[model samples]
Target: MANSPQSKKRARQLVRRTTVNKARRSRIRTYLRKVEEAIASGDKNAASAALQAAQPELMRGVTKGVMHKNTAARKMSRLSARVKAIA
Candidate 1:
């Protein structure tokens, strides 16, 4: 329970931020899923394109603090290598 006026306002702000962060995370997941789908479909061109689009989105997630930079980097590296392996 928020006792003071400032605490109440902070609580409200937290709720709003939580919603925004949730949406951001969902969006990032959607982008990643698209890449995964493309890869699974075994279309090298489409997979590459999806990976291109997803890379920036993943980096943006890192910049916005939704994900860690190294995590994003590792994801990118693995995805790129997989993409490379696709004929």
Candidate 2:
């Protein structure tokens, strides 16, 4: 479908970017899952630690254009609240 050379190059770049983005998204989900597991275990300390670890990853997703700034902020807010509630 990409008849033009520029279009073909763009298609190739898109494929590479898609893989990278998928990896980034998966990594973020793994971090979030860790926090969820920590919270589920009812360990406030562990949940706090997990949330701390996930915060940067979530923000990094925002910076990398994998997620929106507000979306990341909202997720962080809700996760921190849940972490705080794990008493």
Candidate 3:
């Protein structure tokens, strides 16, 4: 119940921001899923390429405030390790 005009405006803005953030989060998840699929296929080359493609997207999520920097770094580390293991 946003009685104040300012509160109503804020609520509207929150809806818009939520939509944008949701899209960003979904995009990042899609990138991560690509890397996971490439890794699961056991093709080192493909996995490496997928990881490379996903790295920037993940970092972009961090920069956009959709995700944390440390979280992105941890994901990159684990994915790269798995990619390396896909020999």
Task: Write the residue-wise lDDT of candidate 3 on 1-87 in tens digits.
Answer: 999999999999999999999999999899899999998989888889989899999999999999999999999999999998877
Worst lDDT 10-window in candidate 3: 78-87
- Each candidate's clash count: 0, 0, 0
Local lDDT at 1 for model 3? 95
lDDT of predicted model 1: 0.91
TM-score of 3: 0.95
Q: Model 2 reaches what TM-score against the true structure? A: 0.98
Better model by lDDT: candidate 1 vs candidate 3? 3
Ranking by TM-score: 2, 3, 1
Considering TM-score, which of the candidate structures 1 and 2 is the better prediction for this target?
2
Best by lDDT: 2
Residue 36: error of model 1 in Å? 0.6
| Cα error, candidate 1, residue 61 (Å) | 1.0
Deviating ranges (above 4 Å) for candidate 3? none
Local distance difference test, each candidate: 0.91, 0.95, 0.93
Each candidate's TM vs. the true structure? 0.92, 0.98, 0.95
Which scores better on lDDT, 1 or 2? 2
